[model samples]
Target: MTAEVDAYLSALPDDQRAALSDLRARLQILLPDHHEVMSYAMPGFRQPGPKGKMVVGYAAFARHLGLYPHSGTVIPLIDCAPFKTSKSGVLFTPDRPLPDALLSQIIATRQAELAAGYGKR
Candidate 1:
């Protein structure tokens, strides 16, 4: 994990930290080749290489934690029912973290978008 990300997580409350840390661990496994980064003030993983696109990101909020796909289109493509969702992220509490399958789907969708040259700046 990057120092920026470490510090970000370190500053959160225990429950939020634990929840995000667990999610981070799962992401590390899913995107083994991706590099950890802090983008848009949130911690997330980006594809490897200097120009690698951001694949996924997440953060802790006052009332919940959010998973950001880095692309506004990604969250809408997935089934985020039973949880709160915005155009670019999904929110859940530490008590009810996102399921493994759903997280995987979120990552997959974002990766696909990156591969297709969406979100290029």
Candidate 2:
């Protein structure tokens, strides 16, 4: 994890911090080649491509955690019935973190989109 991301998570409440940390670990496993960074004022990952840039991000909020798939188009296409979602991101509470399957699907979809050159940096 980057120092900026560590500092950001350190400031969050315990539950939120733990939730985000777990999510970050899962993401790292799924996208091991991606580099962690601070983007859009949140913890983000950039997969090195012909043009390296942020492919996903996550943030802790007072009421929810955010999973950003970079493009507005991607999150809307995800079947997020179990959780709350908007064009920008998926929202889940600390106590009810996103399931591993759902998180994997979201990351896979975003990875596919990026590979297809659908979402530019």
**Highest-lDDT candidate:** 1
Candidate 2 lDDT over 4-111, as tens digits, reads 999999999999999999989998999898899898899989986656857889998778899998888888878988888999899998889889989988888888
In model 1, the clashing pairs are: none
Model 2 has an lDDT value of: 0.88
Score candidate 1 by lDDT: 0.92
Best by TM-score: 1
The parts of candidate 1 lying over 4 Å away from their true place are none
| lDDT (Cα atoms) of all candidates against the true structure | 0.92, 0.88
Roughly what TM-score does model 1 have, to 2 decimal places?
A: 0.96
List the candidates' TM-scores in order: 0.96, 0.94
- Tens-place lDDT digits, model 1, residues 1-121: 7899999999999999999999999999999999999999999998999899888889988899999888889888888999999998999999999999999999888888888889677
